[model samples]
Target: MDELSVKASSLGDNLSAPDGSDLPEPRRDFHDEQYLSQCSLKSRDLLLLTCPNLGLQVCWFLLMSSGTPYLESLDISKSITSLVWLTGPIFGAFAQPIFGILSDESRHPWGKRKPFILCGASCVATCFLALACAEDITDGPTNAPTADSDSTKHWYTQVFAIACVGVITFAMQAYQSGVRALIVDNCPPQQQAAASAWSMRWNVAGNLVLSTVGFLDAKRTFFRPEGNAKFKILAVVTTACIVVTVGLVSYYVADSSQNPRGKSRQPLTKLCWSMLCPAELSKHWNQLPPVSHRVCTIQLFAWVAWFPVLYYTSTFAYETVLPYNFARELHEKGQLDIRLIEHAELHRSSSMLYFAFATFATSLLLHMIEHAMPAFDHTQPRIWFFSQCSLGFCLLLTFFARTGATATIIISVMGASWAVAMWIPFALISAEISQPSPSKLGGKTGWILGLHNMAMSLPQIVSAILCAVILGALRWLNIGDGIAWIFRLASIAVFYSAYLINKL
Candidate 1:
């Protein structure tokens, strides 16, 4: 009898108490039924969770809006400078995927996302400083012409600045991935779209902040912002925002530490091997459902359509338009130098801020429509389709822009599309994977989202490569207003992207 009883207890999870009854196991908080059933977080918690993105968005806009012009300010050839632009998309290609894998599998006590967030924020601050100080440290000319560079002179300063930008892009991509995964982790699957919508709102808010700030003259204020001084001002302002927002979110928010339901971790070496190997990672890709594939495909083309616009809008304003505005007078006076370039870039930068405002305004309108009429939810695909097509039409209009102001107006209107693009794809992905409880993709949410990000980055890579080849040819032929034609050409891709969205 005793031997039989011992076998029974051993076979079962229950122990043989004095009464020979099983004791119930302790309930886990992470897997609490009540928590899983909740659709969304409270407004306060949601705000805290999304706060970091505000600063991050501002950092990204500052870079995309000004980086090209700033690089040109150093007198670097656009062909060679296009190579610097290439680093952003190159690192972007892998940075999110690798960071996503790491964040998903991380067993850190401080939290999976927190460590990455902290590390990325610190690196971003340093990288911005490095970019700001590039000319000073490498002894490169602080002010190069906006219109063109003298190819004969070579400066190591431009090289160092380029390196800083590359490092910063990787860090930025990782930081953004962490924040995104953290939001996904904290919310229930049902709230994925809402969560993504909130994220987009924060992004728009950041742009509004930039639009407000762009009007002020840094030199007129306390900073005396000119040349590298503007960059320093940018770096310092970003640092303050990061410290406040990232610090708050990282401390106040929680994240999944490897597994939410249980403590299990894949071997670290194996995870690293899977990340580095295309074949190994392909296994994870297969786990994603059809919706993930469709959404990611759409994102791929959508970004391809947008990269040139993002990178070259300011360039279009500065290169194609600014030349007509100021270049003729300055060239005639034999005083075509740094001041002319600075003023032109500053003017274009102010105009780019209007692009931000457009994006912000559009996002606000969308939120209102969605809130005021829940029935409009059915029209998302249609809304996305038309919005994207509008950008395509705007790109075609770029071919006819005779002045910087006209080009600025075209870029600003494109932001309405930008608003939709930012929200829908991510919200769709989140909604898809969440509907089936833990999801078929399961613990691989981070990996799946990483792949989605890869979709966006890869096209940018292709776009950058194309830009380099085309700009080299243009510069070689001594052609101005070439970017206008490039924009008209790119509109084809955007229209096709609109078709893809309609198919969705």
Candidate 2:
């Protein structure tokens, strides 16, 4: 037996022994069952568990909402922008699971999760800061937009920027997986649902903040910075928030060393090798519980439809809707207006803000529904199916949208799927794997979660590959000013995901 089981067995024997008979209800008071099941956390602990998510979400939103737009402003080709954006998902595909396995086996004095969390947060902040000033920092010949230089120097700056983004993306994955594992470690099995609910709530809060900042920044109301300068300012704000929030979480949360339930860890080298070689990890994947199997399948299909919406929405809006409107208004004058580009930026930011609000509102409604009818559980496969259908419908609606407002409204409706997509898979998976039972071998929690995360990573890789194809083999289908068909494909994938959820 493992140490946890041994201790529990010893406690049971002592409590029921003759000398202890005088003690009233020793079994009730001293049983390990009660101790493990009743490990309820206070509100303060929940807040600590959630703060890092706030910072991380802020950074994530800023990057996702702004990154490609910033690149496009520099007149970078769409293909190159997608390639730059691909860096994060590609790196994260390896990084999250690897970090997860490493943290699982970690015996660091400061704790397994905390060290990575701190390191990741610091790297994220530093790299994000670099991105904020990428224009200023990349002094190669490419930066001089109006000046002439060898194509090599210009490409050098672009490559450097992409590299920085890749590093930041990799670091954020480490921070994300670490925080997720820490929450799993701290919460007992029974309370995990509540923990996940609160987690979703906090995530919405972060989105709200992110959207508000994005809206304000786009209007240039929050800062005087023009062009990419505004992103630089936002980057500063993002860095400070991550540093302070992650620092507080690190200082306040106790180390995992204080809790021992599992067996000796596998050698780090073995885990590393397994991650590097699919054959080594395939057994673990095949052996996953039925519920995990279901959740992973759902997640994989869900993201295939979701990521394109996220990565390409702003670009689509600019090319298909906003520019046309701008052209229509300027047609009478028979002159092209440069100011339309600025207006398009504002419109995209507004759309982002609306999207965030939709998520926030959907989360609140879902919470109320879950509370009023506990039978309608948040992680129910049918609920996911319905949510996916609704999201797919919204994406399909975008195909016919003739104006920015119509597109924005359609995306706002998508917030429902977005919230469920973010919340359900993790909650369902956590509930299945995070039982209080002692580990028969070392806890497989890390690798388990890592495998599920790979589902997310896979879609990104697929999307990147498809992005290249859409630009090449499918160029003729760019019927909606070059990016419309991608939405239709995403819609089909989402409906298929919903269908898969029904099977699950």
Candidate 3:
């Protein structure tokens, strides 16, 4: 969120010249320049490089909406499903930082970020393929699906699916660190905000595409009977997209680094351990300036409010609005009804569409704010504060949302908050840390980006751990569906998060 007034001089100094020149340009275009001033890359060029996010978002939305339900489809117990729900946050918490440090330390010929990005994309694709074929691989005598009479011989498939999820989640986390670091490593300071905005916009666009696909697939019951074929197709489509986009980006987009070969560190293991170690991080934490502290704090509060909503909205809506005949179907047929699954899928996709649409609108709103308020780094604390409050109020309305439209509308409004939560904190933190010395920040971009990711992943882990207990307590209180109350509690967190913005 760099102020427009002071950007030209700072951006020029921060950006390197083209044609291997050491000199910085007198001024650079905030809108036109992609990463380097004299480099031919435009913002649209960077956008094309970032299209891999489209694939990532497609896979992510599929997992979030369908992963737990897939476990249930395998007839896995609630306990395992709940544990599986925690996988992304748990793996992400560790994987992102490790990937960050590795990318920061990498000296590959392709570039620091590209190698990790390619590797991560490959691993994710492999895992998705395995997941897509889970049923086929596990259809032997020990793991084959059974009839209604006997216990289903599908627990083995369930195990395989969960394993695939774990591996995929970790791989995606690795991919995320590299993808996010690409912007930091390449984009000049002035365009960082625009970079973040475009990334978010692309992210929402990806979400929108997947949501529409899911909705249509669900409506048609594209995968009949067990309804797992759609996921297989989704996995295949997303994997292909990942490989192509990541490969294209790797091949075409050169990283704008003056020093392509950074000094190699000591033992890789020790460096990774230090990066992952809380004790080691605390040392660096103590050295950071106040703005850095504020950014992290805001991230913590904001994500604590956000992660639960992201993880549980589908579950909550399924349980509350689309309550299917799970018990009756289970008792009579020893499996949940396909109708129930279809209903949930429809709701999940429809709700996601609204979420994406609102995110698009919110992005525009943020753009207006940035243009209108130039001095405060294109962001006002009060505006962010208001957005959070509005989100909390919208979450409050979730309690009364009876129909699908009601839920969609409420969550759509929550998008404004999500936009700010996702965009501003990263912009603020990156800007704050880059100010002391842009070159140093460039060297540690991956590390700092990793720390910022921790500010996101850590809260998700906390929320995942606490969600069951909170929902259980709500159920004990005998309120109208404890599952639905998760949204209400999240609203409370959002409100408190707004109060914390004053400190920023």
Q: Is candidate 1 or candidate 2 better by TM-score?
A: 2
The digit string of per-residue lDDT tens for model 3 on 281-327 reads 87755555566566766777677768767767766556555543344
Candidate 3 local accuracy as lDDT? 0.68
lDDT of 1 by residue, 206-262 (tens): 777755565465224434435567657767777788889998876565454545345
Model 1, CA-based lDDT: 0.71
Ranking by TM-score: 2, 1, 3
Q: Which candidate's TM-score is highest?
A: 2
176: Cα error in model 1, Å: 1.2
Q: How much does candidate 1 score in TM-score? A: 0.83
Q: Distance from true position, residue 402, model 1, in Å?
A: 2.0
**Which structure is stronger by lDDT: 1 or 3?**
1
Write down the lDDT of every candidate, Cα atoms only: 0.71, 0.71, 0.68
RMSD per candidate (Å) reads 9.1, 5.8, 5.8
RMSD of 3: 5.8
Residue ranges of candidate 2 with Cα displaced over 4 Å? 1-31, 74-76, 140-156, 220-225, 258-262, 323-334, 338-343, 376-379, 437-442, 473-478
* Winner of 2 and 3 under lDDT: 2
Worst 10 residues of 3 by lDDT: 1-10
